[model samples]
Target: MSIEKFIQDGVTGWMSAHGEHSDIVMSTRIRLARNLTGYRFPIAFTEDDAMAVDRAASGVLLDTNQPNYSYMKMSEIPSLERLVLIEKHLISPHLANPERHGAVLLSEDETVSVMVNEEDHIRIQCIYPGLQLEDAYKKADEVDNLLESELPYAFDESFGYMTSCPSNTGTGMRASVMMHLPALTITKQIERIIPAISRLGIVVRGSYGEGSDAPGNVYQVSNQTTLGKTEQEILVDLGNITSRLIAHERQSRELLIAKSRLALENRLFRSLGTIAYARLLPNGEAARCLSDVRLGIDLGIIQDVDMSILNELMIFMQPGFLQQYAGTELSQEERDVFRAKLFRERLNIANAPASLEEDREE
Candidate 1:
């Protein structure tokens, strides 16, 4: 039997049963665009640093009077170790999940009241019941001064000196959140909600954040305000949108779960096929383990050659090693030859013997 085909078939069977994970469509929140008046600062951070900043921004770090960024732990990514903390931060909590806002400092004197900056624009953001509209607006304005000071040199030329992107020249703050609501969209009633949300300065995008979703199951809510509404007024309308976000998430969750279940039917899913094929291999896990040892020995590749030997080498072992003193082994040369052959075979598909592919071609 073809080793590759067997592995594929076995893996497919196993995964179909386990691959259909129970899904939950959650409401995701983030700051989008804003009126950046009286602000001077850097543009977006590097991707890695931005992600770290994203985690930091969700929590309530500073209180209103001396509102500033609260220093939290460094980012988990080791590569960005020397990176300085970005000025913005937040703390998000859901009615059905954790509820926190802004990053509060754990000071040496106490566990609060430290500041990261003095000026920036503020905007309220919420996609659930726990954070009320009043509190959301209040919290947003607290950080209005963060952008007043000097920014990193990176923001100097391309996006600098009050001539940044045309839409956000002053008070550079953008607010938005992810919402899932299909029933309204499916029944075509969503068109009605759009005019209302648009009137409130909100723009909606499709699934995964862009383009239109004909099914209208998911949407990203973002700001489109240009009429000089106060942060309070903007959030009042936004808060109205957030309050309705929960209902949308529930419907989306059910649809996703149903979709996953259908993907699992009849072993058509790739994940299921992979597992089924693995189990059906001739040596099963054991045969491959022996072959690996043989190839390693042949290629003169010892444990030192591949630092990834621990878990990967023993991922799946056959029953023979424990039963017999003779374990599967290969010389260094053998391993090299095997690898070369695999590539050669792949390149010369027509050279393969009179097999199934040829039969089909005929």
Candidate 2:
């Protein structure tokens, strides 16, 4: 079955399995490449792409039944074959290390290294909690029923099955989602946020939120290691956070813009201009946060066709992801303009080309 239906009923089952004691759990720890330091890369989508993925995370959020986000989860086929394909772009040649497992870690020219493992219960990280932990708790079977009771078959066969990570058994869905909250995380008691997030059944750790929590403004929330939650449920939960954080982030950015200072603006500007990348400037021919939604739809990573997702994606633009996701690099001026304006003309959506004429004729 397609990922959609498999996830619909499956995730609800997983949510019900939350408190089941038989869940085999394991610890998870991964690292990013030390080289990735900039903020802009794969640029955010434009008003157009925002229209495409509107307020949702992916196309998955079109279903209105589950307004609560975690009603669904994200699932990608993580098989050896799939890994080989993704490795071509996302990572380097595979390592034959048994101890570290068939670990695949690589970044674009060492800018970002991804330490991912299925058994680690961390395909990525994310979270979902209610007014209290007890209120949020559910049975493990609920999660499993909604999550298809197995990892995507495609990912399982190729990546091989792993059973060591305690937190990655059962539902085996770890969603590492990042949400901007510069308003609360940056302005408040830089220390108290950790305790607050921990109380939510979510762990905040490092730039990516690993073991213990850190001063995370952009939340990397996810299910605990080897906990029971389905892809459907995870997506639903992620949607909830995505909406809330996007709203908060917008409020914070407005606060910054309204209270722009010589020192802070310069710091933000300098941060954009001072990237040490070998290719200092990226070409402006790719999808931009404000442009390209009218042009290349494939580059739209956060496409769910919702206003909330679009708003979040727009605010989430750091210089690094903007450049990386976009096939071309960006100039310093373009970056600043993007910051000042919510949308800019980054793509020539109206330009006619000989290639397009040929396609039409065919």
Candidate 3:
């Protein structure tokens, strides 16, 4: 499958709404970083060295006889197209960097993506929808095993898997789940939960991971220390903590309803109205409003709109996607206008429950 065809398919696999706690838990991801036996780390590699690593990794992945696999060189793809891949979470920001000599192999459904010559020689990533860390890990491990069979991996008996970063030298695995935590954030409980989770060897990052900001109240929670623990152990610890976090978020939502149902309903209805009728929508504003609308749907307040549309909007509203759909580079103002138009058309405003005024009277 060509990358263009993949883009045209829209949100699929991990980005779709499925799995446990789909309302709160957005997606789960497993990433394994590894270096080739004789090659230098990506940071120190010359263009030739990167190309060699890319060739080796891509060769193994493409030869797997999987009709669904598609491979693309980073240098050959357009800048906007690369950003689209990142937006879809099919590739990481680092892999999209033009200065990096890398290639990516992706499964047709986009559940698995192998990045070659990014921070390491190979990055095997598997993502699935909602609270499926173990499943994601299992898929990633299968890809890792395939690569290890054909390409030699750097390993240390003492340290386990060798990696470019010292922190990832052990299992070389990072398991994370993206969660929607608007209730916690609005109640100011997220501030406290983040610190507490960090103390427990679990780290919370933004939606796009590490350095990105968490728009739409979406955060990624993952294991912080991979050095000493076994892969199963890491999954268990993170899973337990995530379950607790989900419970807390649900409790917080209930608290809001019990404390001030009218106010909460008003806020959510207003959010839905804004997105459904607004003439222009900034990215940040759109994210915040969609978060509220999603909360309303989860709480059984908004019954008509499908959760899948919101999920697709989350990716389609991004800059890269807007431009890709437009078939041209868009100015900021053009994007805002286009975003609003897209939301208005996609959202089912005609059947949305009458303004909360009727319920307020009761």
Best-fitting candidate, scored by lDDT: 3
Q: Taking the tens digit of each residue's C-alpha lDDT, what string does model 2 give over 1-362?
A: 23223211112111121221101101111221110111111122233432222222222222444222321111233333222222222222222222223232221122122223322221222122211112122322232223323223213432222333434544444444433344455456335755764565455453234552322133455544434554456546644553454455446545654685454445433432222111222223211222222111112322433322222233224353333333235467554433222122121122323232242234
RMSD of each: 19.5, 17.1, 5.8
| Model 1: per-residue Cα lDDT at residue 154 | 20
Residue 223 lDDT, candidate 2, scale 0-100 = 45
Candidate lDDT values, in order? 0.32, 0.31, 0.88
Worst 10 residues of 2 by lDDT: 33-42
Error at 18, model 1, angstroms: 31
- Clashing pairs for predicted structure model 3, backbone only: none
- The global Cα lDDT (0 to 1) of model 3 is 0.88
Model 1: residues with Cα > 4 Å off, grouped in runs:
1-131, 145-163, 191-196, 206-216, 240-362
TM-score of each: 0.33, 0.35, 0.95
**Residues 93-175, model 3: lDDT tens digits:** 99998789888999877899889888888999999998898788998998888888988899888899998889888999999
Alpha carbon deviation, residue 108, candidate 1 (Å) = 15
- Two-way TM-score contest, 1 vs 3, winner: 3
Clash number for each model = 74, 104, 0
